[model samples]
Target: MGSHIGGDELAVSNPTRAAQEISQTIFSLDLGGISTVILNGYDAIKECLYHQSEVFADRPSLPLFQKMTKMGGLLNCKYGSGWIEHRKLALNSFRYFGNGEKMFQRISEECMFFCDAIDMHKGKPFNPKHLVTNAVSNVTNLIIFGQRFTYDDRDFQHMIEIFSENVELAASAWAFLYNAFPWLEYLPFGKHQRLFRNATKVYDFLLQIIERFTQGRVQYSPRHYIDAYLDEMEQIANDKAASFSRENLIFSVGELIIAGTETTTNTLRWAMLYLALYPSIQEKVHREIDSVLNGRAPTMEDKQRMPYVEAVLHEVLRFCNIVPLGIFRATSQDAVVRGYTIPRGTMVITNLYSVHFDEKYWREPAVFCPERFLDNNGNFVRRDAFVPFSVGRRHCLGEQLARMEMFLFFTTLFQRFHLQFPQGSVPSLRSKLGMTLQPLPYSICAIRRQR
Candidate 1:
């Protein structure tokens, strides 16, 4: 029964109904030959991921991830002292580059370039996918490589396309089958093969960049993440257990590039789709941006004054629920949750989709209402169940940076243009399920807003 219910169908199908049918927040299943546990609802998620985070902190050795990552990078590395040191370094690096006035300036500059690219469309219908993705990925590129790429850089563009393709392939039915039966990867033809090929291409691109940086880099005068990581590798060269190495550095940078790019890019795309679908919400958001910024560049400081914009951004995160299952985790040791004993190494799937639409925590869970996030006085109110970044120790590493990018890019676009569907054509709101939930391909007319 577990094998029948827990295949590719589980990846694309709604797990909330299954949870309802079973009438349990926490349940176990045999996925292929692997023991797996699913966590549903806010309460169950909070108990396992937050209160008992350590026991459920490690990442599972899924076959696909094991093959691609070799259990070396920060995201999929086994939980231990090595992971601890790498995470600390990563957190500190993020703080250095992702916070304060400098980071705000960086994102605001990209917003200008983004709006300029859209202006090239001249208010005609065009899919925002490429421009939006380039803009978002540039921000991540700046953090990791100390520079940004022009929108026309074919190499950079190709790398982004590869990243996007791998994401969809990783979440496809083939990836699930590959994970269940590792031997299938040996076959010559399958989506799994494409997945491997894409990984190799991305790794090659990153390696070239790393090699260039290594040669030109100054010792201890780190220009970007790569330089800093190199310095760490040199210092820890003699430490046998240290996770810092050339190979790990490559994988770590790749993980950062993907994580920092994909989620925020899709969220921005979803926001535009939603705006086109519901013009009234877009109008309100535009009014908020205009009133708050008043023809000025938006910074993190302006976010507090724009309550409606805040609510809309939060709503987009909740409504879209990108990264719905989040990064899969494993038990560090035997654990008990709500009287259920889960053995050590059991795979844990956090049903973030269920939490976002959980009827108990939200009012009108199925509706697209940003107003739900607003108080009676029209101020934005943060919800307890709003875990778009997931929860606990292994939650999104780039959450702060992502929030900054979303707010600045979102407000900038709306402040300068009005998004609307092409005449007589309304795009479907239905999402394509990949590793992240993305809007179906849609084109919108971005008419410039005259003050």
Candidate 2:
């Protein structure tokens, strides 16, 4: 398997394409001597990741993650009682600050700022990367730090830059080698070294913020994630076996910020690019916004009435296939999946790209068609194969929050601006792979609409 499919192939190429070449939905490859199973297609993925979730609930201890995190955070932690406790607390905290009227209001407020920042371009062609990232980061900031940073804040901007760099580097060839060979870190130079340095800088920055909150935080009265976590730590102080610790807190907060910000930011960026590439679709979205919103701010309630907009967003997620190979999972116990026996501790890779593009489930899967998500009457219809967030336990923790942010941010932008390519500049749909599948740098003009 290793001879036929090397680490470089897995690192650079789409897993779905590799699966197609091999003509197997469930196949195993020896990744640097580590036994790894690739689950492709919707049915195969559904049976294992959805039905037998617990069997594949544990995260594989990649050398890269183990060195950076020491397996202490929610994302890379081993599945056990401690992880369960932390996940529950995180979910509860998300519910407390990330739901209902308050959550909508917070995202809506950020949406205005996002539009204002874009409006500064004055309809000229500009790269929307930083502005979009800042906008999305601010929403996550509100939940984690209880405040939002200004778009021009240098420190916040630096933090975001480093975070984005780390995301891309983590999926680089060097990072893959480092993961396969744990001892590569001892080398004098490599991208892995820079990865470590950037990680330390981010940790230092987060630690500073956590220290600031510690100064004024009151016990049992929480204002944000850090406060709530500190409160939990105090409660579990005497419990020797509990997993809540200062290190875990920092790692978890970092995870939340990255997970919450990067995927949604990139998704919105893709949405903008797609709209520019396809003007007819953009016109239809404008018509829906004009008919339903009429220059008014959009709320979550408005999503139900605007099927076309909803369909567009859904199609963006499906077509783009962000996070194609979701965070790798490990088998918690020996399990039989699709008549094959996967031993305990084997690494499991869920090919979300395959699920989204599964021919058995979608018609003309390669085409960029939003109407596929709508029925004959034009109402949005949910498809079973759409699993951008994955399925069952250990799926994206920020799924709900991401959905809200995407809807509010997406609708708000199209509601106010006419997004299109600059004159004589052709839009490119090509994507650069990293931790997520990001659209290659493209410029779009956001002309304000006459309401």
Candidate 3:
């Protein structure tokens, strides 16, 4: 089944169809194995998933984290009593540290820097992947370490490049093989080992950053994520069950940076590509921006006035949820759902693509249409299926910032220039699934938009 995709078995090239057929067993049908259970349908998937007191919210065990991190990775932990403590502490810490007026100012300042950097590209043919990731990463960096890096910074670029590769590898067949079989991970394939090694290197860097921040080596007031964690650690110094330890602190930063930076940047990349491939839609967006923005950097307030642009952004997310099926979850214990008994440890997944593109909820699910999100008054209206940031207890920690980041960066860029794909090349708008759904590597020319 690992290599079965795109083969003759399905005889179809559609990802949604393939996903539906392949994943019809969690509540409706069952394949014969104990370890393998496929979640079927959107409602059954959501019902069985959201009810799990998060007991099944544990990520699947993988060799890289298990062996490399010694099984203490925050992202992989089960959502039991202990995990609940950690999750709550982390969420509280995020709220305390981020989204404040000062942080919003920081985000705004960095975003202007981002605009200037793109201004250098000058609407030319270029691969904006690293730049886009770097800009978004800088937001998390400021939140985590209270620092910024130049685009050419060697170490920073290495980390982003390696992390991006890891994201891609996570969706590759190789990772699937490694996760399913523990022993094969040790084999000398440079691909598998290198990715894990780079991850450890990243962890080590994160740990060092944590140590430096704790040691007061970076100087100035520590107002970012790590600073908040250190502060919590100090206050909870006497609490026996405190989850604000050094390890959890590091993991929180890791999850925040990785999850926060990767998703927003990838979705922006996809949006740029789609806009480039389709000019009339791009023109409409530009027209909306012209009326709403009036030649100024888009303020957060401008979002309400700019309906078409906002709807287009929503459509971009709807069509290509970076983590298409979202993070895989498991069952808390044996429970009956949709007339079927699911055992504990069953891998439960939410097919976001299913929800986003479900014909029941959407019209012309295959085509790119932002108007679905527009109301009669032309305000951006959200649908129940708009779970790009996810829903329920474990929604994205950086949802607020991610939304702000996407709207700000996307509208600013589009208002300034028209994105165009390379002449004579029509790139596929479909994403390749991984831990995140990412667009294939492609370049686009950004022709400056006429005033």
Please, what is the TM-score per model? 0.96, 0.96, 0.89
For candidate 1, write residues 125-216 as lDDT tens digits.
99999999999999988778888999999988998899898989998999989989999977999999999999999889889988876677
* All candidates: CA RMSD (Å): 2.3, 2.2, 3.6
Off by over 4 Å in 1: 1-24
Best by lDDT: 2
Cα deviation at 58, candidate 3, in Å, is 3.5
| lDDT minimum window of 10 residues, candidate 3 | 25-34
How many backbone overlaps does candidate 2 show?
Answer: 0
C-alpha lDDT of all candidate models, in order:
0.87, 0.88, 0.71
Clashing pairs in 3: 26-38, 56-330, 123-446, 322-437
